[model samples]
Each structure stands twice: as C-alpha cells, then as structure tokens.
Target: MTETVEIARGPYRAQLLALGATLRRLEVPDREGRVANVVLGCRDLDDYRRVARYYGATVGRYANRIGGARFMLDGREYRLPANDGPNNLHSGAPGFDQRDWALEDADASSARFGLTSPDGENGFPGTLRVEALYRMEEDGLAITLSAQTDAPTVLNLTNHAYFNLGGEASGRTILDHVLRIAGSHITPVDADLIPTGALRPVANSPFDFRTPKPVGRDIAQDDTQLVRGLGYDHNWAIDAPGRAATLYDPESGRVLDLHSTKPGLQLYSGNHLADGPPGTSGGTYAARAGLCLEPQLFPDSPNRPEFPSARLDPGERYEHRLAFRFRTAGSVDEAFG
Candidate 1:
C-alpha cells in the first residue's frame, strides 16, 4: 500500500516494494515474444507478512541456520531466538525481511534500499549499516549487498526469490527445470536440516548436480538428506568462484545464470510453499512451485570454523555481489560469460 519502485529496460520489468525491500514482480520475455512473471510473490504487502515470510525479500543479519540458535564469537557466546526448532533461521522472527527499508535512491533501471541494525538487534552484537542495491543490467539483475559494523559480529545476507522460469502462473511446476550446480560437494545436514559440519562428495549420489539435470529427476530417490529437507535444501560449496549455478527451462526457452562472490549457495526447491495467498501472477502456489538460489556464506559459518568465516569487526566493511542473468537457450552461453 506504500510507494513501490519500478525498473524497466529492454523486455524486462521489475517492481520492488520498500517493505522488506522485496521484489514484488519480475517479468521477462519468452522465446515467443510473450512476457511472463517469473518470480513468486504475494498480491500485496499484507499477504507477504501473513503468509510466506521471505518470498522475494532480502533476508539477513544471518541468512541461514545457526545450530542451537547460538554461537561463540571471540570467546563470547551470543544467543538468538530459536525460530527454526532449535536453530536460528533468517536471523530469527521479525527479521530484516519484515522491516521496511528506506528508499535511498531509484531510477528507471535500479533502486537502493538502506537500513541500520542496532547493536544487540536479533541477538547480534553490532550497530550495522546495510545497503541492498539493485541494478538492471543488459540481460539480468545485479544485487550488491554491503554492510559495515561497529562491533564484532557474524553476518550473512541474501535475496530470497522463488523463481519459476517457465512463468510463475503457467500452472507448471519446476520439477522439469534443468539445473547445473558448479560444485561437486555439498554440506550434509542432520534430521533438523542443520549442517553436520561436513562436506561430502556428491559423486554417484542423488545430490549430484555437477552436470545439468532435471530437479525432479532424482528428487524422490530414497536418500536421508532429501528426506530431511523434504526435497533439496542443502548448500553447495562453489567449485567455481565467480559462477555458482544455472537453471534452464526448456519448455519456455528461459535460462538463469547465477554469478556470485559468495562461497556457497543454498538451493531450495520450495517444499513448504503451500497455504500461501494468491500470487501476483494469478497463481496459487504449492510445494515445489518454485526454486531459490541463495548465494551467501555457508550455513552456521560462525559455529563451524571449517567453513568460511562470516565475522565482521569494527571498521570492517563487508561487500558481496550477485547477479542472476536471464537469457534464452541459444544465447545462454554468451550471456553467462
């Protein structure tokens, strides 16, 4: 119900809401010259709050799970609200996804949202100034997340956008979407979906996405990890630094190339997307309706020393870049590089 920003260029158009600095709509053209909304989202800001919490919002403080909802930073233990069973999820309830960011700047092709998180907010020890910048590029969107803290604390930020490149309301599930992850190893998780602090080879296993494969091809196989996540909700360590993964929809001839500076990516196959309100694209969402490619620090990075550190101290500026480039079948290769 507030003022929303719009970005348009070429055949792409996106609507961004200041509430949560969330992406409300993303439309691109298919091969047939017909445009379709590709991202899942609610009809209004109220629906976004009552139903799916993340949707197309920027999630943070710490983006993923932290074991036991607590972690030790510099010999000091920090306890966060247990939003996900016994673990901290998306920085707990009332997270950044629930806040309305200040509209710092906007234009025809980009928008900038800013927020300041005080020390002790979300149980993190820092007064952090943050920014989520969106820039519409030649064939895709680039998001830059940056932050600076006044105290030592752990932080990981990411955009949680559920995408169905076949067109969000095509009444077609994303099970047939082909995906290629840039990693051969994935962080295994426990029954509660918390990382077990071990990176296991996906070779010859159902977790293998080293090569291009359909999401539903091996999704129902009898596997412990799949059972725990209800589908695929694990993080893949990036084998290639600049590029993390790619998703292609053969039916619609749409492709998404993911390039990021983060070390890992959480590939979630919208297992719990049901019971949501009507989507902006006139579709009622259900489980596995869309998929998320969240590029960020490893889950529970603060607790697992083996993972890349997510600590930012006084005067230290944190910055990361992520881009999701959209292209058609024939131009996917050239657009990606």
Candidate 2:
C-alpha cells in the first residue's frame, strides 16, 4: 500500500510521498509567519503525466546525461535512447523518476522507497536495485540514496527540487538571493549543454561563486555555457569533501544549507519557468523564480574520464547523502551573518 510520512517543524510542514519516493512538498514560513510551499511540484499524478520533467521527484539509473546515448561497457558498446537531442538525458526516454516505487518503510521522520530495474530496461546491462530515503528532522531534510547493480553499470541519483525561499508566490526572482558554492572549477558544457570533458576555473566568469554572490550578478554575461543553457545549469565541481553550499534569502531571513558527499553540484536557475496553469499556491511561475542545487556526479560523467567515476559493479553499494537545513534569522540579525 502507498504511504505518506508527514513531518512538522514549527509552522513548516513537509509530506514525503512514496508514489515515486518523492518529497512532495516542503511548506515553510515566510516573513509574516505565513507558511508557503517553497518547492516546485505537481499537485497530482496526472500533472506529472502531462509533464515528465520530474518536478520534486527522485531521478535515477543516471541522473544526468550520457554522451550520444551510448557507452562502452566491458569493451562492448551499449546503445541507449537518445532522448535529449543526441545525448541520453536522465537515463533514457523513460527514466525511473516516473515509476511507482514500493514503500519499504515509513515513519514520522523518514520514509524509504525501493525499486528494481530489470536488465536491459534502459539499455543498461544489469539488474539494478535502488532505494531512496527521505528523512525530515527539526533541523532540515536529509536524503540518502543507495543502489546496487548485479552486473557492471553506471548510476547517478539526485532529487530535482526547485526551491524558492521567498515562497513560491512571493513574485520575486532568485537573483537577489546570495549563493556560495564550495568549489572553484566547473565542467564546461557544449552547445547542447553536455559536458565537454574539461574542468575550467570559475574565475572571471559567471560560474564563479567562491564568495557569496547573487545568482543574477553575471547570469546574462556573454559566456558560452550560459548561452548554451540560457542560464546557470552546468555542474560546479565541489572540491571540498563533505562540505556544504549555502543560499541565503535576505528578504525573508531564510537560509538553505545544502550538504552533500557528491563531487559536483548542478545549480540551475529556473530560466525556462513560465506561467502555464496555476501552481500549488495558485501563483504563476515566471522565469528565474526558483533555483535548483542538485548534488551528484557531473553530467556525462561516464563519457568523461577525468571526472569522478559513475560505474557500479557487483558486491559494491553506491551510497550518497544530501541534507537541506533551514534556519530562521531574527529581524535585527543578518541572514548571512
């Protein structure tokens, strides 16, 4: 049976749904103690059916792209579906984000979803078993992803949560929010936004966030990657081990701290957001209204040797953790300070 885990923190209430093992909603308080849903999500399963972009969903098998939808495994070429132009994005034509996962366990603070992918399901040569655990604590939300393959294969899992700290309907762009990543180099992408197998320094470029900077500070600059993605959608190589990146909203005095064990973090400023129908809060989503910080292996990592490996073999368990902690600041105190 499907289950829902509801966890509460002050005025904030979060519901972890086991449908796809997704963190469905994260309601947090705004400036006036009024709670608003900050994460972008679909209200029902039908909404996800119409839009397969995996909003607030857990993506797996491979979270990003695989070059040309083909990869060499054990000296043999495995061809996958070319879903994203000429590359295989987020696994293939039909990834695991939309599949109904089994609820393995659930509690007041945590819930686990498990799924097994048969061999050759997406042209991957292995029987992959994966689990996604969502745990909400008084401090924040913690997501732990683990997977094991019966044979050799590639795996990269991440959550696609679009966050707007000022509330979804606050009618403000994330440009004013200050962001700081714990890395100096970023994987440059090609014209199609696929990694070009080069780790370039973020110095003197819009990718640089060594210090706290607003996302819109250099987003519109004449940068090739920015031009390709239309904004910040490339992965930044996180140099420090077990470090956390932070985004602070000065207006609401809310801080979102992202801690992860992954080597790279993809900072996507929702440049393509548009007002279609109304959203959860009956607000129209405009461009740059939200941002995503997906912590995982770099995009097209299987095709890039210099990047961290995404290969999973027998007797090996792939494990990674990401935490999003929220802290409130008093009216007189600085949010970032």
Q: Would you list the clashing residue pairs of candidate 1?
A: none
Give all candidates' CA lDDT scores.
0.88, 0.81
Instruction: List, residue by residue over 140-204, the lDDT tens digit for candidate 2.
Output: 78889999989999889998888988877788989998888889999888887888898899988
Candidate 2: where are CA atoms >4 Å away?
1-4, 9-12, 30-33, 275-277, 330-333
Please, what are the lDDT tens digits per residue for candidate 1 over residues 155-232?
A: 999999999998888878899988889988899999888999999999999888877889999999999999999899
**C-alpha lDDT of candidate 2 relative to the true structure:** 0.81
Number of clashes recorded per candidate: 0, 0
TM-score of each: 0.97, 0.94
Which 10-residue window of candidate 2 scores lowest in summed lDDT?
328-337
lDDT measured at residue 317 in model 1 versus the true structure, 0 to 100:
88
The weakest ten consecutive residues by lDDT in model 1 span 328-337
Question: What is residue 105's positional error in candidate 1, in angstroms?
Answer: 0.6
**Deviation in Å, model 2, residue 230 alpha carbon:** 0.2
State residue 253's C-alpha deviation in candidate 2, in Å: 0.9
